[model samples]
Target chain A: MHVLRPLYVVLALAVIMLIARSFWVPNDFGTHEQGYTYGWYRQSNVEEWKNFTVKYRGKEFCGTCHAGQAQKLASAHHKDIECENCHGPALFHPADPLKLVLDRSRELCLRCHTSLFYPTSQRSQIKGINPDQHNLGLECTLCHKPHEASKPGRRNR
Target chain B: MNRRDFIKLAMKGTAVVVLAKGLDGIFRPSDVQALATPLRFVFLVDTYKCIGCGFCVKACKLENEIPFDADVSRTWVERYVVTSEGEVFADTPKEARNGFITGQIDLGRGKFKDIPREKIKKAFFVPKLCNQCEKPSCVQVCPVGATYQNADGVVLVDRKWCIGCGYCIMACPYGMRFFHPVHHVADKCNFCYHRINHGLRPACVQACPTGARQIGNIKDHGDPVENIIRTQQVAVHKPEYGTNPQVYYIGLGEEVR
Candidate 1:
């Protein structure tokens, strides 16, 4: 009888909790919106998820201001390439448009055009040239244009 | 009460307890309607196309607000170089900064020591992220219902509900789950759920220079992922575990884990 008394109390507590849960649990809780988890958790996760502030605003963002450059890039072989890829990230462009520095260095071009150590099948084949043999000391921009580095004897777009 | 009467009462109590256990299934959340359709999300990583540039790692870190710590990265690139003698050296440098070629191999267990490249066989870069499994072990083990999978099959952790018990971290077979250094809660990749829900690619995919990483819904026949899966031989990591990982690999060699 003594053991049964505690069992009865436990049963009563269990029944009360079950009833309270039905009332306390949100209607949408454990539903599809919450993925059948705790109801309050769904609400919390939704509120926590916020749009991340975009840092690299692709070519589309750059094209908004520099329409002429955007138009030129569209017709060139480098049309698909992003402006920030070469010019560097312009996070504060509109506020400080001067921040977009022009990288006319030969190393910048070699980063992609150089004969990389990677296998021929893997690395992109753009006329692979040994930097030491071709230009020696001359700048890449001196002979090849930055925007459209077309093949030899090909007409620039 | 008499001994016989007490036994009868105990039997009745046991029966009620058994019935109560069965009732939980009846009370399961009806929101399973969210998964009514066979929604499929495919993440394809082309090992051949990756150049080990680590731009994707940089982009993911910036976009996700992850601190600049080598150990706390959400996504990382591993470079595997095989030797002529069949020796394999695998290493992941600090964000693959100077590329995958320049890193020492000391992961405590000394899995693969650094070997000089003169006797090289073949080298490749493998990028890794959370699998977003269909039957996520993390979701099944979460006692507080913190980890869950959405209707579209993206596994996510409810940060607020997480009890920091570290069960999900241990449950994940891919070793993708990590206790967030700052938040002190279990965190892993959700395929950029915040961005994908808004029709944007994940930061890593967007930042990839070689178009090595591709993600799309396989449910839509018109989607490129569906065509790729049909045309190319796609594979998931550790299929024997039966986690049903959504991430697929293209050009995955036998050497890769």
Candidate 2:
């Protein structure tokens, strides 16, 4: 009976080790120690986001490379906005170039760009964005370039 | 006693008149929607700065991967030509054709550049996209709940849920919604929920070379887009339709006269 008791104790010890390992360390799927699949996903806040960080909408970077563009963009709605905000996860910027995920769509623009709409006003003559009539074979990039403002004339600057 | 009672009744009658007047304001339909929790974002289109360059059109095509040739375009920018005599006309492509003005490299320069100062009556280019109508007609007519107004007041379509029933296409007075050929479902501008919730601006706003497209949170007092609209006398395209569209254009000129 005493010998059998020792065997049961050893089995119990092994089981305890297994349970402890689950909490104390990470497995292939990830755990408290290993966190999420993506390292950035493990982060808890903007600061913890690791790869992506706000450099003040990168206005300062623009200031260093293109001074005039920084001046013009600084005063617009984009003044407080960060470059990574529109460009998406720019974790591998100049180093990898290709990793720059750009978010481009009219729907994204409508987020904050919707203020100009006032349908009930007495003086409001137009009805909506009227994608058909107003925008003449052109696009938003024709005039506005938030990141570099690299228009043909301003490209060198 | 009689004189005292008569004076009291007169005072009571006056109070009722004043109360009736105050109640009138409650019943008046003066944008009761504003009282409803203001939307997360407000969209603004600065008509004054838009030069009809078609950049928005090209960008939309590339970003959304819309077919190069489809009569129903998800997005396109056109030129609105208003003459001196007050006749307005928008020169939009009749079909979803591409490679327009490829050789035309005069990026809104020369010829009419002088008109901003003198003889030109009112010739301006306004880039247009989906208004994401607040009271979107698209939502009302969708046989399946494919199209709906999101909590933010932006109209969106669940492509997977859509049965390709073109009811929403006809319901929309603005004609912003369209059917996708490959997916065989309804599609339109979703305001890029992918980037927006992640704290990023839309592509058109970022790509705009002229600062024409401005986006902001309209409901918040702190948002700049709200101030831009408040200070400027912006107008919509078809107010008579009553879609309560969110896209606003400042300095709207003559239309299709």
Best by TM-score: 1
Q: lDDT per residue, candidate 1, A1-157, as tens digits?
A: 7979989999999999999989975554454443333222454465456354555667787889988888877776666456765675566677855677666766555644554344412643444456668667777777676566434324343
Q: Point out the worst 10-residue segment of candidate 2 chain B by lDDT.
A: B96-105
Candidate 2 on B78-172: residue-level lDDT in tens? 54444466644444552212212221122232422212213334544556678877667777776655555544655556554568989988887
Kindly state the number of residue pairs that clash in model 1.
3
- Candidate 1 TM-score for chain A: 0.59
Q: Which docking class does model 2 fall in?
A: incorrect
Q: Lowest-lDDT window of 10 residues in candidate 1 chain B? A: B97-106
Segments of candidate 2 deviating more than 4 angstroms: A1-157, B1-38, B69-71, B85-87, B94-120
After best superposition, candidate 2 residue A65: deviation in angstroms?
13
Q: What is the DockQ of each candidate?
A: 0.22, 0.02
Task: Score candidate 2 by TM-score against the native.
Answer: 0.52
C-alpha lDDT values of all predictions: 0.70, 0.54
C-alpha positional error of residue A17 in candidate 1 after TM-score superposition, expressed in Å: 7.0
TM-score of the second chain of model 1 compared to its true counterpart: 0.82
